[model samples]
Target: MAIPPDIKDSIAKVKPLSQSAVRLMSIMADPDHTVAQIAAVVESDPILTGNVLRVVNSPAFGLRAKISTVARAVSYTGGNMVVGLALHLCASGIFNNPLDGYESQRGSLWRHCLFTAIASREIARFSDGKADPEVAYTAGLLHDIGKAVMSAPLGDSARKIIAIADKGEMPDFVAGEAKAVGTDHPEVGEAIAIHWSLPGPLREVIRHHHAPSKAKEEYRTLVYAVHLGDFIAMMSGTGTGADTMLYLLDHDYRNFVDISAAELEKVILDAGQEYQQVVESMFGSEEEMQ
Candidate 1:
């Protein structure tokens, strides 16, 4: 679908997806790249190298790695881990702050998105291996691309539209967004995903995360995973904003993914254990919040 003009203009103002992140994703997607090649890319960029070192020696690793070189970092965690950290560092720019019109403070949207990403990866792990955890992580990270697209145009008016939706006056939250901004976030986000050359399934996750049942058959499980991740983030109070009331739990997911509430609870707790560590490693320390 063509992007709504107002939302497109807003997307225009927002920072484009990082080219370095895009290149890293492309290289990672291909298995032909050797560890040396990946390390060389990180070594050439000081900022990227610093991010790699941070994750390598983070609390998540359970010890002070004290690693000093990009190649050694790559050796410690393998090429795949390096790619993941590089992706995290590169993708942080567009998502590193709270989106105006979508939240009251900076980093709120990013916090919510990170929560969803973490939950999505964990969900994929316990879904009988039906989902790809790596892809799930990427999808969760970018699921709210639409809100970012609307940031500039919607500005502070998100609350007004959200109020209208919360009052049960619209078909759903997306409808409320359409009424206020001339377009909805899901569709706008889908456009951005396609323009970014994301895989078809990832695009579906971005577009149908709020309504997983509407997704195509092949991508339904991935969609459901993101939907649950989104719900978990909302329930956990990560950064729901006005969406707290607008979205509902997707009950139909049980038929596809086999997870009990007890298990789900455990998942959240486990994710919580590493949440701060993961966030600080990817985005930076609490200094980012200030």
Candidate 2:
């Protein structure tokens, strides 16, 4: 599966999502945008509106009243959180499809993305980092999108990559991907993010999540959050797919963020419970293996 140089270059030039994602990113950048304005944009896309409301009423928020509209959900959860959560919901279908050799169910990827998004937000809050929780959430959710895309067109190569990864370890898996597919999932995800016209920060986060040290300060934090969140989810036996065996807990990551082992454990524990409730509410099931 030698990757052609042309394909590699083409992938490098890939754009992000269409106008919808770009518009949402623009609104997110505008601090002056009210909840009503943000909700209006989400409402313009009926599917996004419905998903937002579904998330708001889910156990993740624990709202007592049923949220019938995007506006109320945004108002209830605060604009920043709503924006991040909305993006996750809106894009879920795009990444939720089954992949050969991945071992994830129809919506498993979407569930894992949402889990990481929530966990990343909690980590940022606990770290007291200036990082935007919404941005962190979005970065975490889309971190592995490349794997989804690669699985589609390069199914055989993807299987070989996973096979080699399972036989060795995390770095080995990455190496195998580079050897068999010309690039790893992180790079592929970065390419896809760029193809979709996602924000620069997000594109970088997706590119470097597996190697946070390669990113700049802000992007480094985003990558770290996604890395930690994904590690915790994999350990918890939550929708890690065939890639679960490749999971590695990078101890040095805490050196960049100054979080202790005890603190890390707490974040993972709390996130597990939240993950359960959120998954149950969204998919009507708490059993990840089911």
Candidate 3:
């Protein structure tokens, strides 16, 4: 679907990710970027380096030993995980705002995004071969970027959409956004990703997460992972928005990831534990981030 010019303009006004995040993302985009290169970029910023070590030692990675150095963290968790940790830390400022349109309190969306990203990583790890953990993490982290854009400058419009959504007039947040703005957040997010020249698969996941079957076949697995992760985050009450329980869980999610109900239960349980630690790694505590 083509993005409306109005939505494109709205997305343009949404702030770009921080330069440090962009640099880490650029390095991660290169398949050949070495762990040393990733560690070097992360180490350039003391905060990012600390966050990387925090994440590596956190229960999120299930590491038996604490990592004290960026190089060691990268070696322990892979370059992609290290880069993702850096991006999350550097980009926290951007996600810390309240999403008025989505009814997300200050830092709520950030918590949701963090949980979803971690859930996506776990889903990929258990996919048996359908997805990449690192790629899934990035996709899940950014799947709702357009929602932020839509919520930033379109508060009144979003209120109207949300009212309609509350009445069951729309299928989900994406549908309500399209009804109010002539384009949904996913489309606007796709445009924003294109504007930023983000990787193609990342753009696809952001665009088609609401409809993974409609995405390019190459990215369908990744999209499915993010979609399920998003659902899991909402269901787990991981600091989500008013749209919580508004979206439908794909009944056939098992077809994509081959995870049983029992396994998925474990994922949600583990994600809740990691979510607290991940949030602490980036923002200290819920009170502080807010």
Candidate 4:
């Protein structure tokens, strides 16, 4: 289906991922890049550096000594983690708005993304998959970026799609979205990711998090990680939106990862508490009262 002209125009105006973020991902992709080189690139952007430090020092990592510098953070979290956190920090502002049809509040979507990211790391740890926990985390954080893109101008259409899905018991929200808006958020998100030249795996995860069975082998694990993480967060009521429970678990997802319903419950319970603490630390005294 062709993208509607209005939606296409809005999407055309949306900014690509920041250059600093692109540079960081490039450095991460290069095996020869050293810690100092990565640090140098990150340090060039003061805002990005500050946000990265905030995340590393937040309750999530729980480091003993306060990390005050980019190099120290890179040393502590490793290059991949540093890059992941950088991407997270850079993209945090993108999903801070409410999608028209979704119940995600201002910043609520971001919180959901954050929770999914944290849960993804836990899933990775348990499955012992080749997936980098940090990469999984970043993928989880960005899985819903397309919703943000679609909602900017197509908010009304998106809202109608969600309403139909909710009222008619549609099997898939994406189908409802396609019926209402000519495209699903995942496809739109993939387009946006492609425009930004995101890492291939990260792009695949964003495109396929909602449908992990369709992803390539290497990407399927990460996709499932984010998918499971999203479900766990929604079920736990961590930072869920309107469409939180609109989707069902893919049967194939069960075969890709070793997580059980019991284990998932435990992760959600634990991550919920950690999520609140992290949000409190990140926002300082303004943590959403739930």
Give the candidate number with the greatest lDDT: 3
lDDT of 1 by residue, 48-84 (tens): 7887887777765655548888888777655544554
TM-score of each: 0.84, 0.79, 0.84, 0.82
Regions of model 4 farther than 4 Å from truth: 26-38, 53-67, 74-89, 153-169, 285-290
What tens-digit string does per-residue lDDT give for candidate 3 at 1-290?
56677667766765566666777777765556788887887788877777677767766567777778888887876765565565556555446678887777877776777788889889877777768777788777778777766775456665676678789877887777776666777887788788767888889989988788888987788888998998889888774576677676666667778887798899999988877765665456778667
Runs in model 3 with CA error above 4 Å? 1-6, 14-20, 26-34, 45-47, 50-68, 73-81, 89-93, 157-163
Give the C-alpha miss distance for residue 159 in model 1, angstroms. 3.4
Clashing pairs for predicted structure model 1, backbone only:
98-107, 101-155
Q: Score residue 270 of candidate 4 by CA lDDT.
A: 84
Q: Cα deviation of 51 in candidate 3 (Å)?
A: 5.2
Q: Please give the CA lDDT of all the candidate structures.
A: 0.71, 0.66, 0.75, 0.72
Indicate the residue-level lDDT of 203 in model 3. 96
Q: Could you tell me the TM-score of candidate 2?
A: 0.79
Q: What would you estimate as the lDDT of candidate 2?
A: 0.66
Error of 4 at 146 (Å): 0.4
lDDT per residue for candidate 4 within 1-290, as digits (tens), equals 67677766666766777677788777755546788987888799887788668767877577898999888877765665555456555665566655656655677677777788888878866656566676777677778777877665445564565667767767777777777678777888877777777889878988888888889987787788888888878777754455667787887766767878798778888888767666665555434421
Cα displacement (angstroms), candidate 2, residue 271, comes to 1.3
Candidate ranking under lDDT, highest first, comes to 3, 4, 1, 2
Stretch of 10 with least lDDT, candidate 1: 281-290
